[model samples]
Target: MGDSIIGGPRIYSCYKCRNHVALHDDIVSKAFQHVCSGKKEDRQMMTGLHMVADVHCADCREVLGWKYEKAYEESQKYKEGKFVLEKYKIVKENW
Candidate 1:
């Protein structure tokens, strides 16, 4: 079977902070840098004890989504090395 839906490229930005997060068809996740876990900072958690960090806008600091520091399941090990963008926190812009 082939993909039933065909769509154009999407640009995702933070809804609260209006910061450009990613281009859906392009780079989806960026590298984690200087992330801290606390009330005012990016929240960090563990999925089955695998570290995951919630990312936020650099300027306005709105919660965007999370980046997996380690993979919880062996089958999903690829996610361990990348970021996961939240759909609810982003707006899609299409050209």
Candidate 2:
């Protein structure tokens, strides 16, 4: 038999926006957390944690725009440097 190997997928969660996005865990924690949000909730009888996304205000649970881990990173980068926002990837968009 060939070399049989098994590996788990990397999960990411945003800290501020509470949005969940799946990406390689090899990334930095600060970058990961800044880019990912939401809690890792189980959807049905799953073995791994399913990173989900949620849109709401930080102070209040007010319905806001679409939130994702990628945006988290974009926001941080934008704030740090006076750059444009079109470069970042907008995964999800809320009405």
- For every model in order, what is the number of clashing pairs? 0, 8
- lDDT for each residue of candidate 1 in 1-95, tens digit (9 for 90 to 100): 11222554455677876666666554534533433222322233453445666677776777677666665568657666577667787786664
Worst 10 residues of 2 by lDDT: 78-87
Best by lDDT: 1
lDDT of 1 at 51: 62
User: What is candidate 2's TM-score against the reference?
Assistant: 0.19
Residue-level lDDT tens digits of model 2 in 10-65: 43333345454333442322233223224433232122222234433334343332
What is candidate 2's CA lDDT for residue 16? 41
